[model samples]
Target: MPSIQKPLTKRAWVRLPSGRRLNLLDPTPFDFEADDLALGAARTVRWGGHSVWEWPLSVAQHSLTVLAIGEAEAPRPLTAAQKLAFLLHDASECLGVCFDPISPLKPFLGEGYRQLDQALQTAVHRRFGLPADLPPAWKKPIKTADKRAAAAEAIFVAGWSLAECREALGIRAAPLSADPLTPIYGGLPWEPWPARIAAERFGAALAGLAGSMP
Candidate 1:
């Protein structure tokens, strides 16, 4: 069957590496591949490229760090859906941008930005057999894990002192000194990784999570 035609407006079409044009205004689960999400995320810089490392931290790496942090803090092992959520939390940011918009700037971008993100997120969730929204049981732990990930990244990669993280970044909780991924990924703990390596590692995890889904 012929795929649905692109939206009338030219701006709606975003061409992917596989030559599939995703309609950002109305995305579908089949619009992209896991590899596409992984590569896009690996290239999307976090902390606005302000990291102390040679290369800026990528969302790919941050997602994994968040997973590791979540595992360390969880009362029990995270469900596969929850783990998938953590890995794909920032997947939408990778669609057409190379940088994550800082929290302060998201408001100015208006509801359009918010809707686009939600649309893509919904598609991402359905694509992997997850609920359109995160389960309530999963939210609190993921939020805390994400914050902890930020705290760690701020201090270790972005050159922010712990005090600065508290006073300036408003992360009151303490950051983790040891990264859970160190044993698996084998790098300087919490340091930013090159985009290529980040993508490769992220791809491995993405495949595992997606395959685990019923």
Candidate 2:
């Protein structure tokens, strides 16, 4: 089967030791390029889990959530730039996952996806003028919030039983309707959430982060 083609500039491709390639655009060359790449990539997908119509959450929305959580949990004050970095954290996934979660191909996810994702992340950070390596101190909090989001998602969106989730996560499940899961991608019928809605959710989460700051 022929794969879908994405438009790319030659400068975007950088060679790796393993002979793999990456997209590492020069940050200063384009204005708002990071945002543009992220926003554009969010519109499509490579692989996503089974849900209503085999749908999955979009990277754009997820990045927004991460930003919200970062703002809410970051111990030290973050500049506007840092906040943007947080929101666009998963920008690489905007293109597609290095590997997607699914049966028959699940094993590829462990090391293959990890290396690719890390490279993409490094490239994105360098492109956006952020540090190449994530600071160690911030790691745990970000990961914790990510897991909490996962837990919340399993109960609300994936149709997991509360008892099953409780046994897995060791926490009582709460009412899911209050924080109803919004589908990032549309179904085969193609009923997607509005881009404005995605932006709004992102903005609100970013605001919440500010509120959580000391």
The candidate maximizing lDDT is 1
Tens digits of per-residue lDDT, candidate 1, 117-214, equal: 88888988888888999888887888888888888888988999989988887887778878878998798887788989999999999999888887
Candidate 2 C-alpha lDDT tens digits along 82-195: 675676556555432323343235565688566666666666666555667767665566665555555555555555667877785454524233232334333322222444
Lowest lDDT block of 10, candidate 2: 183-192
Candidate 1 lDDT trough over 10 residues, lowest sum: 95-104
In Å, residue 195's CA in model 1 sits off its true spot by 0.9
Off by over 4 Å in 2: 1-32, 44-47, 52-55, 74-77, 96-107, 110-112, 166-214
Give candidate 2's total backbone clashes. 2
TM-score of 1: 0.92
Q: State in Å the error of residue 117, model 2.
A: 1.6
- TM-score versus the correct structure, for each prediction: 0.92, 0.57
